[model samples]
Target chain A: MANLSALMLARDLKLLLEERSKAVAYTSSQTHSSLAKGLGILGFHPSQIRKVTCDDSMRIGTALLRSAIEQDKALGKTPFLIVGKAGTTNTSTVDLFIELAAIAREQNLWLHADGAYGASALLCQSRRAILCGIELCDCLSWDAHKWLFQTYGCGMVLVRHRQFLTESFGTTAEYTQDAAETGESLPNFWSYGPELTRPARAMKLWFSFQLLGLNTIDIAINRGFELAETAQSSLEGLKDWEILSPAQMGIILFPFHPHVPAANLDEVNMRISQSAIENNLAATLTTRVRGVLVLRIYSIHPNLSDDEMLAIINGLDQLAHLYLSRASKDDII
Target chain B: MANLSALMLARDLKLLLEERSKAVAYTSSQTHSSLAKGLGILGFHPSQIRKVTCDDSMRIGTALLRSAIEQDKALGKTPFLIVGKAGTTNTSTVDLFIELAAIAREQNLWLHADGAYGASALLCQSRRAILCGIELCDCLSWDAHKWLFQTYGCGMVLVRHRQFLTESFGTTAEYTQDAAETGESLPNFWSYGPELTRPARAMKLWFSFQLLGLNTIDIAINRGFELAETAQSSLEGLKDWEILSPAQMGIILFPFHPHVPAANLDEVNMRISQSAIENNLAATLTTRVRGVLVLRIYSIHPNLSDDEMLAIINGLDQLAHLYLSRASKDDII
Candidate 1:
């Protein structure tokens, strides 16, 4: 067992020394699994890479790559990334793609951008800037799930150098071959991945992408963004808590004022959202910020309306007033 | 940045400490994302983990937990898991749920199996062993996007520990609502997770699960297992390659025969897998035996029949013969 670990470690070191490391996992600290995997598959130790973030609970993967490249001389290592959405889960933050692409070119690194969540934002005119340099990336990823409103596991990794994926992920066994080593354009994607007999998971994504088309996605993106915008404005300074990050797309993060007592801000935000979710109401929560705790509500569900957003804001206002009153009484005591 | 890493590290340490951690994440090992994430989210440095393998990938996870208990002696710190099946990518590597449940009970750990790939096996009579202890699991995770044939991001996390999830992951805000300390019967899951206004990925999975019931799933599992069994028997006693682990449900791993000239089983298996994938076949490669390097396959599609598996096996057998012939000639020369 020690020998196995040693051999594995040695081979990894050899890859490091030989600099044959071809794939770079570009993940924002925000991305859950997509970015971490690029490096994991390429045989990297977790600490050997960087997962950069932009805001609280978001990652600026593009910026991190640029930083890696800019500091490559000092740090002595180049970075390849499987970049993804910056502030996802809440579908909020996004990385600086244009800058990351430029760094990819300068550093000769493979750039795999993951827009699985926010890339759905590409359909929107306002949010399109967030993905300005996507085409320039060596690879791109997006989820038919999440904002795409498709099935889960409908996440895909699109490599600009499709051949690289073929090189890294593809494989074949002649015994399993339907035919000989002849010249035919057989998809044999089985060779380009690490799994055999893969589920036809792509069909749903393809179906939904075609079914809804760009207009629907764009509208969804716009609506979610609009809701966040309205909620942010309506709830601003209307409470004891403060809003931290404003609505980027369809997310808002703020916390109950930190100086307050063990205020169950987490509990309160949950109640308002629960009031909505349980009654089949429309809303969601993302994460806590500034130790104050926050909520994020963003989506493209037709059920979510402007009125719902307004109600959400009203609920926040009411909660804020109650919290402030409670805090005041606590202060008096 | 150091602080963030420190916090992540601290969180991981707490997960490994003698105290039970919160919001356990149990998934099958075949889902590479879950494999990559086990320690990262738990807040460990990642080194302390040594993956468990059950000759098949199923054992790696169980082994890891056993290692934690026997090696680390952090028995009281219950670990979270996510098992997989229907979307395991490796169809045959369905988790030994009964064994895992036993382990979970013994260690006070939370079991969240990711049956995203192999879960389709649940519908089978012979493969019923895979799902034996499934109901006992604290949580069940599966990707509808895979075999149930949904689209991407169709992953579902089903919790048996309904109350625990609320306690572990519930949150809210006063600015959102105070609820008057009122009676909120059910808590919103948005707070129980790390997302806000999450996409309606649930609808797709819900639709499929409700529509299909278990009968539909059983047929697919039976069919896939048949294909795998056919493929394994056809390739038995091949010249250079041998089945390292034959299919139980759909996953198969075979290493190079010890006497084969391309002795580095990992390298040879990798090369064969790489070549096969480039040809656009329905296959790929992975390293579950870690350093052992074997050709692994997962047959999961209900659309595929046993004959298809035969065609694949024939192709592999031919390749092994060709390789052996070449080696013999080289030795003579």
Candidate 2:
């Protein structure tokens, strides 16, 4: 929504193309679906939104992005915005922000970092280095609910130039003239977002931070990293399991590769997850990596202990074996 | 945002207009700022949104709306939407929804009811008549947080057709194939709204309704109406005030009009509200009714008693006198 607001202002002021046909936006294949959904809401056609392919690390290739921009220009399309994912949901992969930022500067495209889940990692000194070039981006979105442990719907959008937001959303009317002319009070918050009557979403996070302190938050983030590392090492001991991607931040992707000739490994992996869910074990869902289904685990719960992690892994193994045995025997069918 | 989403769908499908130039939306001058802010976000210029004149009772004059639509058409603009204020935020005034709905039907325009605060009155048998033709609206936006007494940010949008939202927002991708093919389970909520990972806002309302029976909630709504009526009658007994609007869905609007050459009644009305706030009395505010500033009271707290209402009224009367007496004496000014 923030990026859409900026784009609309640019178009309204003739900074970008007045016609929708010439405007284009770039996003990595690993980017969250919300971006595509927002673009659709803003009246962008599927052809106007170009999904750039990611490399093995699931980061948008700078060379490929530059080529796509050149191609769009050659095709008479004006590229305007590039969205870089600070941490993707599927594999929790952080993009090459420094390189992406450089490209955005050279190409004059608005860079918005969709850090709904990963931006909070910047609180931890050990993990802050991973987001090296994030400061160079024009705007960034962060969801405090996901990482700061606040209640739901507490998302924040930060812009490098503060006036851009008000310039995009501000309106004048007799009812609101008093507040607007005061010229001394804080900006009317309604002029900064889509909604006029908004919830006090920041209060919850403010109280939480005041009570828990930043030191505790940093420790919780670091603990998540350590837990994911521990889970990966524990999974390495299981011969029938293949770790498709090692731990990043707090997420790991793996799939079941049993000894038996499983006709479909994707089906086997899905069954493993379904079996775990049916047994009421800790949830481990399946996501796609390069069009292949893999079981993904997000170990971000601060309350999770090593013993609990072991129990969940043991449960998955037992469930996978039971399903494989049933498949091999074919029962009476 | 919901209204904006529906408007965007109408424009995108060419049901409204093929381009932004000829498209226009009609809304009462008393409609909430959020709707106007939303239209602005969706690329509507200030000229594209026409604020039709309202009646003395704060209802949209249906005849005025019809002529406005005709004028826009004559000017080569296509009128597509007519928004009826189910309850204006300032006066809690209900528009002539039945007449507006009929005009929308005849003119082939989409009718949206902004009932964020008053729709919950439907649950009360006695007050439901005020929203006589609410069911005829094409879409309605209700804020559960306002009248349902739930936590903040629990708003709902009801579309006449179920598939319209999905058709507007749904996307096909390899990652979501499994759930897409099932076709028998619950709706993929992500496809129905803009955000992919929205907090479960409905759960709070569900729990509130489950814990508090319908009978109790109805009584609470009725109590709010009674409290406002009592406040209005109590204010009538005072000598230096005028009730601009009677109680409607728990909101009563009035202004201080003392017998003196006050010169600026708007400033006096604002001072009354400011004095109330400074004294730490009930948190009352001032709003405009027909271009005149008036003190508005929303007596929605169910636990407020008759005695407490009397105390608030007495406090206002005394505070108004104190300021007026200070002005009358011309002591040192």
Q: Which candidate is the best by TM-score?
A: 2
Residue-level lDDT tens digits of model 2 in B111-144: 8898888988888888888888999988888888
Q: Encode model 2's per-residue lDDT on A131-224: one tens digit a residue.
A: 8788888788888878788766788888766577777777555445446635536667777766655678779899988998999999888878
DockQ of each: 0.05, 0.40
Docking model 2 quality class: acceptable
Model 1 C-alpha lDDT per residue in residues B1-333, reported as the tens digit of each score:
111111222233224333322223343334443333324332333443334544444443666656655544454333544343433443345566777778767866555555656565665777766566677766555556666667655555565545444443344443334332244564554443433234566687678768887677677668777776777887784555677777776767776564654454455555566656765554656554434556666666778767777777667655545555665687721
- For model 2, what is the alpha-carbon lDDT of residue A229? 83
For model 1 the local lDDT of residue A295 reads: 61
Assess the local accuracy of residue A30 in candidate 2 as a C-alpha lDDT between 0 and 100.
Answer: 88
Candidate 2 at B29: error in angstroms?
1.5
Q: How many backbone clashes does candidate 1 have?
A: 105
Positional deviation of residue B243's Cα in model 1 after best superposition, in angstroms: 20
Q: What is the TM-score of chain A alone in each candidate?
A: 0.74, 0.93
In lDDT terms, which candidate is top? Answer: 2
B96 in model 2: Cα distance from truth in Å?
1.7
